[model samples]
Target: MKKKDSNTIAQNRKAIHDYTILETVEAGMVLQGTEIKSIRNGRINLKDGFATIRNGEAYLHNVHISPYEQGNIFNHDPLRARKLLMKKKQIHSLIGETKNAGITLIPLKIYIKNGFAKVLIGVAKGKKQYDKREDLKRKDINREVERALKNR
Candidate 1:
């Protein structure tokens, strides 16, 4: 069998523009049997996804995992909340930090790691409109510089 580095299923590109990621951690997912199969087929969307803690358990919210094509009867709900697996210590810390103003948890990406489904959770703060605009300007500048270098 060949060992794979990762099989990225979905990403939340909006998270990058809306939040300034302070920390990132890989977390395992609690998926139903059919849900995992759908994720393996890259039928997932993280566009509207976020994470929260309830009763000390972390759950991913708003992530859309399309129902498996063959899972006619037992397919999981596409937008149902899914549990995220993480250490007790990590969960506690995130909970504490989120008590402060403007800090929240965002799910950045979903991927398969070593054959297990995992989500990359980012501890992030909401970015101001100006911050996002500045980032875009910088990106354009970098793109133009690369293009000029290519032509030289």
Candidate 2:
């Protein structure tokens, strides 16, 4: 028996800076052949992408999967909305949290696990200006501490 390794593609670094992530879930993406190829080639971007629970299902929107170089007409649309596979209960809960609690659904990372593409989605709350400032302050403090320790 051999252990399998997970391969990660692009990650949304802006999401962490803009939102406070509460919980994360791994969901499978419904992709076409060319789209899959594009993703495997690291041609995907999740910077402005988000997930939404609509009509009892989750869909990823604004995700850009570049056109596959080899596919002429069969290349999928770069900004097409893709379905995300998750349990029914999870979908319902997410819908409630988004609609009632005012949380957001953010796609954190896209990765290949066991030969299938999986997305790590997070339940997040938008960060306030002060919160972002606090994060920056904390980072600076940590950097100062590390520098002091190195010089000692």
Candidate 3:
């Protein structure tokens, strides 16, 4: 398990295992009523979530922000596709990059920064089975080295 920062609400750990992240960009979310409240309460899930650029804009898909308990009828949908706020230049750059076969946009983590909800979006490519195995092996070796150093 990885230690999270105080403001980190959720992380898509599987993204690291399944994708080779090439670059990361911090983007703001256009949230609806009660969504911010739920996020502040840590009622968010990044698993199975991904981002996309469409019609010259960026949007986040499949992210789950649980409805607030006290929100009643004002609560937003838990799995709605939310718009992402990013500069036009950045969006254009992303469009060009994602045009490559197999390249994708994925949300790695979400956190509160400067009192606003921000997501770290990664430009990534899918990893092969052998790549996953190699990552696991690297992790095991690193852990063993750490343990040996601690015992020295």
Ranking of candidates on TM-score, top first: 3, 2, 1
lDDT of 3 by residue, 1-152 (tens): 56779999888999999999999999999999999999999899998898988898999999999999999887899999999999999999999999999999999999999999999999999999999999999999999999999999
* Model 2: how far residue 94 lies from native, Å: 1.1
lDDT, candidate 2, equals 0.91
Model 1: residue 9 alpha-carbon error in angstroms:
1.3
Q: How do these models rank on lDDT, best leading?
A: 3, 2, 1
User: Candidate 1 or 3, higher lDDT?
Assistant: 3
Relative to the true structure, candidate 2 has a C-alpha RMSD (angstroms) of 4.2
RMSD of each: 3.8, 4.2, 1.0
- Local distance difference test values of all predictions, in order: 0.90, 0.91, 0.95
Model 3: weakest 10-residue lDDT segment is: 1-10
Q: What is the lDDT of residue 96 in candidate 2?
A: 74
**Per-residue lDDT of 1-152 in model 1, one digit per residue for the tens?**
23534577777889999999999988999988799898889898898888999999999999999999997787788999999999999999999989999999999988887889999999999999999999999999999998999999
Which residues of candidate 3, in runs, are more than 4 Å off? none
The candidate maximizing lDDT is 3
